[model samples]
Target: MTKKIYWAAVIYTILGLLGGLYYRELTKAKNFTGETQLAILHTHLLALGTLVFLIVLVLEKVFALSETKSFKPFFWSYHAGMVITVGGMAVHGTLTVLGKESGGAIAGIAGLGHIILTVAFVLLFAGLYARISDKQPVKAA
Candidate 1:
């Protein structure tokens, strides 16, 4: 599990770097000057993907989070949410760069992604809390 978490962090970092490069080159190629959703892809991937996973790795080392059943569900759901969210960003950003108007579907999809991410957070925290509770040593009254 630790290895998996470490590798996940590494992959996310690479993806974040690639996202930045893609955004820069894409906008430059099109000479886009104004703000677009693409501008945020890099930060989102780095902060949410790379940074979050790195932090999770540390927490796993200390708490052995994967030992909890909730960890598996949280892991899969988090990845699904990220894929949906980042995919929405890429689509919306591309359409923006191309001067195409996206109606409301993109926003809806992104919202769903955020909802899933929120659920995943709850799962993680629940599992962490449970683990901590089990580890607590009662003091003599």
Candidate 2:
């Protein structure tokens, strides 16, 4: 489980790097213009997704998070949120760059993604709280 979390963080980091390179290339080509929606996507993928996952990995050992029933749900929900949010950002950014305005649907999808992210965080916190509250002191060998 810990390995899975680490791998997920690594994947997000690689993707974030790719997004940065792509954004730099687009800027060099004068295609990026002033629309920073994709830029936000790039940063958030690294900052929120990658960084947060890494933090959770560190927390897992301290909290024994694997023992919690909510661990699986938290993991899946958070990753799904990242995918939906980043996917929305990509679509919305592409449309903006193409000079096409994002309609209500696009905005709504993105909004839903954020909502999922919020719920996922809530679940994660609850799981952590449960583990911490129930934790027992370790005995010396």
TM-score for all models, in order of appearance: 0.93, 0.89
RMSD in order of candidates: 3.9, 2.4
User: What would the per-residue lDDT of candidate 1 be over residues 1-141, giving only the tens digit for each residue?
Assistant: 899888888888888898889889988999988778888988888898889999999888788888887899998899989888988998899889888997799989988999999999999998888778985322233
Query: Each candidate: how many clashes?
Result: 0, 0
User: What is the C-alpha lDDT profile of model 2 across 14-131, one tens digit per residue?
Assistant: 9898877766776657655686577787898999879998999998867767667777888998888888888888888777766688888987888888998999898888888887
- Candidate 1 lDDT score at position 113: 93
TM-score of 1: 0.93
Clashing residue pairs in candidate 1, if any? Answer: none
Q: Candidate 1 — which residues are off by over 4 angstroms?
A: 135-141
For model 2 the TM-score comes to: 0.89
